[model samples]
Target: MVTGRVARITDFGAFIQFENGEVGLVHISQIAHSYVRNVSDYLQEGQTIEVKVLGRDEKGRLDLSIKELQDAPEEMPRPRMIGRQSPEFENKLRSFLRDAKERGPGEKGGKKRKK
Candidate 1:
């Protein structure tokens, strides 16, 4: 369990300063549903939000979550917004894919063939 005061709000998420002198990030997507455009839309600096100890990483930093504070059950992840279009949507995506393909396979480029 951890207690903290909200320190700042940014496009990505909110930063909280724990009483024990540690900081944690509560990502905007994790804040709530309905597409959070800004973290300030739901939380502000100096506000207090309860967090559950999710787990710590190899660095020994605490990983906290706020979903525990909500009364309802968890919401399923949403699907991708693929079909949306623009004047050059398909062309832009084609260019992106081409660039990615040109970048080559994972890790260092070039592949070895069995002789």
Candidate 2:
């Protein structure tokens, strides 16, 4: 873990300057395990923080994460969906189509008795 002072802040993330003059970016998602509205809400300029190295980006710049040092929150269970149609539904649909076809257009009621 490297200890660094907040060098800069942006809507996206914060930049930190390490002791050896190395600077790295900590993305907003890596700042905390909870929803963060602003980077300053968690980190202030000149404030020091401990961050774990998350390897480097394609440009060789260091990538860091503060959430990595903390315990992860438990995932909530999702409700089961019981909305599948039964195989017999196909037969019911066919029956309904056949009945509608038997009932010709302009026919309001089920049947009209012969006068």
Candidate 3:
């Protein structure tokens, strides 16, 4: 297993600088099983991720994988949308907006006045 803080994330891959000063590219294809069109969805600069060393390529560069940590499992459950706010909540929101507008700029409301 290779461990390192992500140096940077790019559409093509993440650049990881190892402790020994060697840097490696963890290609987007290897970040996850799901389609990864944007590498930012899976990684961020300074974020640490564990990678498994698959093998060295013909050029003697390391090939890394993030998916080796797991076996294929059942599809993830879809997130449920919560219920809408009640009428009472809407009434409160309207009151708040009206009050804020009434206060106007330079008042207690959240508006900045020209100096």
Q: Highest lDDT, which number?
A: 2
- For residues 55-82, could you state the per-residue lDDT of candidate 2 as single tens digits? 9999999999999998888974567888
For each candidate, what TM-score against the reference? 0.54, 0.64, 0.59
Pairs clashing within candidate 3:
none
lDDT of 2 at 9: 96
Tens digits of per-residue lDDT for model 1 on 1-115?
5778898888888877888788877777677645678778788899998776667678876666676566654676778887768869879888877766766676333333333
* Better candidate number, 1 or 3, judged by TM-score: 3
- The clash numbers for all candidates, in the given order, read 0, 0, 0
User: Distance (Å) between predicted and true CA of 42, model 3?
Assistant: 0.9
Question: What is the TM-score (0 to 1) of candidate 3?
Answer: 0.59
Worst 10 residues of 2 by lDDT: 106-115
Ranking by TM-score: 2, 3, 1
